[model samples]
Target: MTAVTAPEPAEQAKEGEGSLRSSAMRGGIYLVVRQGLNVFLKLIGVMLITRVLGPTEYGAYVAAFNVYLYSTLIGQAGVGVYLLRHPGEVPDLAVRTCYALLALLGIGLMLGLEASRGLLTGWTGVPGYGPVMAVMALALPFKLITIPPTIALERALNYKRVATIEIGGDTAYYFVAVPLALTGTGAMSLAVSLVLRELLFFVLAHYYVGHGPRFGFDGRTAKSVIRYAGTFSFANWVWQARMLVNPLIVGPVAGQHAVGIVGMTVGILEMLSIIKTIAWRLSVSVLGRVQSDFEKIRRAVTEGMELQIIAVGSLLLGFAWFGGIAVPLVFGARWAPVMQLYPYVALAYLAIAAFNIHSAVMSVIDRNTDLGLCYVVHILLLGLGTWLGVRHFGMIGYGFGEMLALLAYGLVHWALARRIGSPDYRLAGLWFVAAALGLFWRQLGWWTIPLPFLALATPASVRRIRRILEQIRKPRRAEARA
Candidate 1:
């Protein structure tokens, strides 16, 4: 074996960053796997608990958990947005201070939850959820407090550590509490699990952050961090509030069981999000690396868009193909409601991917103002759309409404796609499913015949795949001298 010298200090630092990037990529995969595994197990747990506790009880738990999720989003303070927007100039002290503000916000949220549990009980009519909601509400702090540290890890791109902690914690939660849940923890099992999960992250986040539990905050630094993070916090609150309105609307209008159905459908949607995140993980991070070089950024963005299209198209096509068995096996028969919504949700994800490159370019160029404005509008429209859809269309209608909102957003994304950089129009096949569904949705519900129909739905990727096969099969077809 040849003698190998260690890298010099500067070279080692470069190597460290290179390794970190690779780690981030692997961590994205691991995180996706972990989420997939947890969702898979939770599906088992949901099936067991649904069968055990019955619909009303499971609905109560899912409802309370939606509340918990919305609350957790409030405390992010958009630290990730802020950090991602300005990675080069974000000081550690500022990050610490932002963490401080979020901590305070989290504590206040917990207190507010405790103070309002009686109101929630009255509003929800799930008196059993009173104490459980109180406990689950406190989980907001545990979850939110971890964000700063987690964001730091994300910025550093040393995501394996964070991903490991998350996976380990989730695995612990599944193995430990799922049994109690099956034995008959009811709605409380979910609340208890939420607390346990958040607390685990709290401990792990602190360990990763190298920050001891301390309350000493700097007023000056806090003011600065607040000034920067305040805008993010507002955007976050708006987005979270937008998300919360769905459960608030559907639960009251359609009842807890209906909300459970909707949540179950969305749970399937969550799997798509995991796919989207993993596919875009490197694309998003690479935005940071290509900030100033417009020419280089444009080229990188082009390659990234191609990758996003191919990847998301393939995934969505696969999902649309296999979702019939996958949906029922994973989420249980009670959530059979999801069977109706899964394909449309896949279409929505496809629409999102259609503009993934534009999204990256917009962020790389620091177009948050425009992006935020558009999202704010989208959120407002979605809120109205969800309400009308829930009231008029019921479950399937809600899916229709979501698709419409996605359609509206997709157009905006398409228009902006040009502004960022023009992309191939062929990707629009992913977005026009709504147009197709409007034409054919009434004719076909869950077209599981596996005959000629489902193949017709995912035409965008099919065309691309056909082209690729042709290219592969006929590499010399283009090279023949005329």
Candidate 2:
């Protein structure tokens, strides 16, 4: 046999990045379909429950759901990111490390919630949420268990399976949730459905992995993973906590009804947030895999942001155009506050779109310290903004505070990303202006002005759509040409 030689460093990096890009593209396509289905299911579920439970009951569910959401982060203890970052460094050891930590956190959360249900209810002022939250807390361990498989699948770019598991969990949640809500389960509907969803995900994920849960100990790996997890992990926690700022501050000051209003308003924002989620989720693993190649990282960040901006700009503008009329019609007149709150939330998302991939880039570039600092700034700004806004202007003021905080967050990170990614600031500016114009038209009831903004954005949106279609057609096109 002839002797073989290693490829040149530059050439090897090029190949690696190409592979990473292709994997991201393919995985992202599947992810889009998955996220779209999940979004549809969540929207339907929220709409059904909102109509059934009304504000007070829905508010209770939201309060508990927020607790459950934050606890999952605590339960995972940044293991998912750790696994993704170091995919090949003794997978079994990492898995066990994650499992051990997650199990401990999950058990602790479940027991704590069970014991403090009454105290929690009194604190949140959402009467029945104590027990509901306690029950929902049981899902945390199972959710933690699913993370290793998830990270494995994601690292392998096996998003087709990931998509299947997601759709299955979403289906389980809605099927269980809607019927329960219709039968007058109140906040328990959400709590029970969450357990069902997580259990289903756990079962399905394990089946797909073709393995039973393994128990082992790895002191060394645990320490290393936790060490790697430190800065970015804390940063992510802070960022997630920022989401809680409004409800936590508003609930105490304005009562559960106001919290419910904030919940409904955030639901609209979550819908607008789909583009950002899709972009971020798909890009992170890809960025991690290609982290050695700065050129690839830069290209990924820039292109990812562009696509996110285009998608978000179009969706948010369209929502702003029709939201005032649609919110009341869809969820009823009681949710009119959501209509007013949605414009500010939409504007916030617009700024976030400008730097959707920045965090992932930061993680890949070993800038976790900066990432942590960024989130520290974010939480402080958002917390202070929320408190002052709610104190002075009520819910609407809260909305303005959220908008300002997010803009500051986005602009700061966007500047940081520019230093690394070197993207087109002009395009980002245009998207921001376009989003602002949409907000202006919505706020002023100048419906005609937004029409022109939409018109201007339409060409870019269509081009993006065409590129996606071309991606889908590439193989067939090659066959035809051949």
Each prediction's RMSD over C-alphas, in Å, is: 7.0, 4.6
Best candidate per TM-score, number?
Answer: 2
Q: Per-residue lDDT for 1-482 in model 1, tens only?
A: 01111223464357554443454456566766666776676666666665566556766776677777777676665655665555354555555566677788888888887887777766755546576787688688767767666666665556677677787777666665667777777778777777887788888877876774444466876765566555545544554465465457666666777666666666555655565565555556655564665666565554445455455555555555566677657545555566666666556556666555565566556554555666676676666777788789786656665666664565455545555554445434433443334323324654433322343347755675576566444424433431
Residues 1-482 of candidate 2: C-alpha lDDT, one tens digit per residue: 01111234465467664454565677888988888888788778888888888888888888888877876776677777777766444356557767777777788887776787777677766776786887888888888888877776776678899999989998999999999999988889889999999999998877777775665668987788678768767777877886566447777777788788888877777776787887777767666656777776776666666667667777777777777788778787788787777777677777777777887788767677677777777777777887888888887776767665774565455555565756556555655676666666755667545543564457765675577577547645544675
Specify the highest-lDDT model's number: 2
Clashing pairs in 2: none
Q: Ten-residue segment with the worst summed lDDT in candidate 2? A: 1-10
lDDT, residue 299, model 1: 58
In model 2, what is the error at residue 356, expressed in angstroms?
1.4
